[model samples]
Target: MLKFLPGILLLQVITVVLVLIAPTELSGWGWLRLVIPVGIVGVLTAAWFSSMAAHHNKDEISRLQECHAKEREALRVNAERAKHRVIKQAHQETIQEVRRTSTQANIKVGMAFAGAAGIGGLLLLTQFITLGLLMLTTAGGALGGYVLRIRQEKAKMELLPKTKTKPRLINASPTTK
Candidate 1:
């Protein structure tokens, strides 16, 4: 904005000097003709300044709109992320609850089996049979845990929505009408 002021002032000063340095023959109405050049220069100078100002204004507006659009997009993404986080947390909580319940049930069943094995070993009075029964009970408990894990995974899969494929259209026709 400040760079053009010196040039504008210099042009005005040159016009004034030319107007003053004319002979009387060339000075009368001919001197007045100098005003034409001055007017032309003035008009051109005004147009240059006006165009610069208008361009500056347009650039500023474009920058402002760009900033606003970026902010809006950021806000929208943040909102979507927060919503997804909440849903994920809920799903995690449900999984945790299922794990807890399954663990408790497994413990109860394992204890019952162990107690039954202990009573049967006492009736048979054999240490080898008691150890074998204990091993079998542990293996069964492990298998039950694995099955529970599979059930939990199946439940989680069921909770998810199914994906649907969109149909694609293909046409071999040209657009000439």
Candidate 2:
């Protein structure tokens, strides 16, 4: 809109100069007739071009806005996917740690049972029947407790949220107790 200010000013200046310099015979109405029609045409032409420019700008703005919206949506999806991947990795790490600790526990328990059996056999051979039975009973109790603990851990793992889209695990870390 402001771009045509200089042209409009120039036209007004030219009309004033023509009206001032025209011969006295034609001074009154001659310049008025020429200037009025020319001014009208100039104004109409400026308006038409300004309207076209405004329409083009409107379309460009719409296109840019749509492009930005699509980009925003893509960024949101990527962020969600990244969040899921991080959660899944955490879960995998927790499971692997549990397996490693459980393996070690199993080895220790097996050793305990084996030691108990060997000592119980020696005690029995030495005619210590009562002591041998007690030792075996304690080992049995230890085995039972280990089995129960494993069952509890499996149950805990199964308690994780079922939704694959947004899985959540509470108490995912192994408890010492």
Candidate 3:
């Protein structure tokens, strides 16, 4: 209101001067007086409303910005959680695969031992002592060879360094005859 005081006073003075200078026949002091006050009030009201609107718009923009920030944070957190979940699931799958492979290996070893024992028992029951001893010796030798081979292979695996590179094919494309 104070900022507009000088301009309002100047406007009032101009209107009064115009009314006084006008010809008697054209002049209408009554109309001018009423219009002048209404115009000033209208201008002041417009200024006040516009200022209020600007303040409200600023508040609304800040609120929207805050909401957007919170949404972005939530999205970031969710993404991290999803990544962790995928890693955890993959780890669990790897553990399960290892367990399954170990169980299969154990079953195969048990079957081999059981087969050797059954054959040896059958030979002994038929009164073939020499044949039974030979069979048991052969089975033991074979088992020992298998264990040695497995140990050698395990040692080889341990000696080799782990690599992430893909193996190159010896013959990637077929040659034309």
The clash numbers for all candidates, in the given order, read 0, 0, 0
TM-score of each: 0.45, 0.63, 0.49
Q: For model 2, what is the alpha-carbon lDDT of residue 125?
A: 88
Stretches off by above 4 angstroms in model 2 are 1-29, 125-127, 148-177
- Give the alpha carbon lDDT tens digit for every residue of 34-71 in model 2: 67766776687678667777987999999999999888
Q: Which is the better candidate, 2 or 3, if ranked by TM-score?
A: 2
Query: For model 2, what is the error of residue 22's alpha carbon versus the real structure, in angstroms, after optimal superposition?
Result: 13
Q: What is the lDDT, from 0 to 100, of the residue 70 in candidate 2?
A: 82
For residues 71-93, write the lDDT of model 1, one tens digit per residue. Answer: 88777667766766777789789
lDDT of each: 0.73, 0.79, 0.74
Q: Give the TM-score of candidate 2.
A: 0.63
| Cα error, candidate 3, residue 166 (Å) | 30
Off by over 4 Å in 3: 1-29, 116-177
Candidate 1 minimal-lDDT segment of 10 residues: 164-173
Best by TM-score: 2
Q: Whole-model lDDT, candidate 3?
A: 0.74
Candidate 2 Cα RMSD after full superposition onto the native fold (Å): 10.0
